[model samples]
Target: MSAAEFSYKLRVYIEDTDAGGIVYYVNYLKFMERARTEFMRELGYGKDAIFNHGLMFVVRDMAVRYLRPAQLDDLLEATVRLIDLGGASMTLAQEVRRGAEVLATATVTVACVERAGVRPQRLPRDMTDSLRAARDTNGN
Candidate 1:
């Protein structure tokens, strides 16, 4: 990916903060997840559609680095980039930014599995094609 595409903006609310008025560390994960879900939606495979195909995406692993704390009422933007795609899994590089400053960064690996038993399954060809197209276009 170009590293500049697949982005979404959100406002930090009081509910997303901790007792100290700083954004709770875990809420950054939720922001990144929402961005990823919206990225899929923009590609035509929303959450429901993917689930209807008997496939589900599950986070296999994640590593996050917090550079700074965000507070309530902050306008944050999250960007998601496709880093690697595998037979049954994909890796994404995501970040939360305030203007030009990166507040946090995360590398998330997600696996496609059958909804019944969480068994790994190959991603649908169409879905893969769409993801590749998005990545390629963004990379340019």
Candidate 2:
């Protein structure tokens, strides 16, 4: 579970909230996805490279816990860390935080797949190597 964390910040808009001005629960997942995208991009796996490699990642499983609500116009940050690296999948620990308060947390497993048939594919070596470098476990 030890990994370097990356964070992305965004503001909650009216469209992201319900009639009562509370952020819709599903939007949290979107924020986490953005964070993961940025994390990978920072590690050199931009969207183009990933797609050009004939790979697409899909969420295989997710577990989420909601603790607080983010209202309209509120600033929120989504943080992500690579937790597990498997042959064809990886796990991410993500959190949506409003300032210092954690609003939601999630554990998501993403499967690497062939873009056309959705068959499982091996993870990119560069991606895996960078993830291992960023791993905080025992100072790597």
Candidate 3:
């Protein structure tokens, strides 16, 4: 497991909040997803590159805990880390925070799947190697 973490920050908009102006619980997962995507992009294997290799990543499992509420216009930071890397799957630990306050945390397992049938598949060697490089570059 690598200790490297990537952080993405964004402001909650009115559309991201409930009628009461609190962020919807499920939206935290969306924010985590965006952070994961950007982490992959920063690794140089963006969506297009993954698809070109005949594979895509899909969430196979997730466990999330919500600790607090975030209101509209709150600046939220989502941090993502690769906790486990495998031939066919990657497990990520993510946290959503507002300044020093931790609002949500999750552990997500993502599996490599065939782009056509969406069936489980081994991750490309290049991707695995690149992820290792990315981890090292981030000072893991």
Q: Which candidate is the best by lDDT?
A: 1
Residues 1-140, candidate 2: write the lDDT tens digits.
45677889999999999999999999998999999888888778888989999998999999999999999999999998888899999998999999999999999999999999999999988878887887764431
- What C-alpha lDDT does candidate 3 achieve relative to the native structure? 0.90
lDDT of each: 0.92, 0.90, 0.90
Ranking by TM-score: 1, 3, 2
Top model by TM-score, which number?
A: 1
Which regions of candidate 3 are displaced past 4 Å? 137-140
TM value for model 2: 0.93
lDDT rank order: 1, 3, 2
Instruction: Rate residue 121 of model 1 by lDDT.
Output: 97
Question: Any idea what lDDT model 2 has?
Answer: 0.90
Clashes of 3: 0
Which parts of model 2 are misplaced by more than 4 Å?
Answer: 137-140
In the range 34-105, model 1's lDDT, one tens digit per residue, is 999999999998978998999999999999999999999999999989989899999999999999999999
Candidate 1: clashing pairs of residues: none
> What TM-score against the true fold does each predicted structure earn?
0.95, 0.93, 0.94
Output the worst ten-in-a-row residue range by lDDT, candidate 2: 131-140
User: Candidate 3, residues 68-137: lDDT per residue as tens digits?
Assistant: 9999999999998888889899998999999999999999999999989998899888889877776656
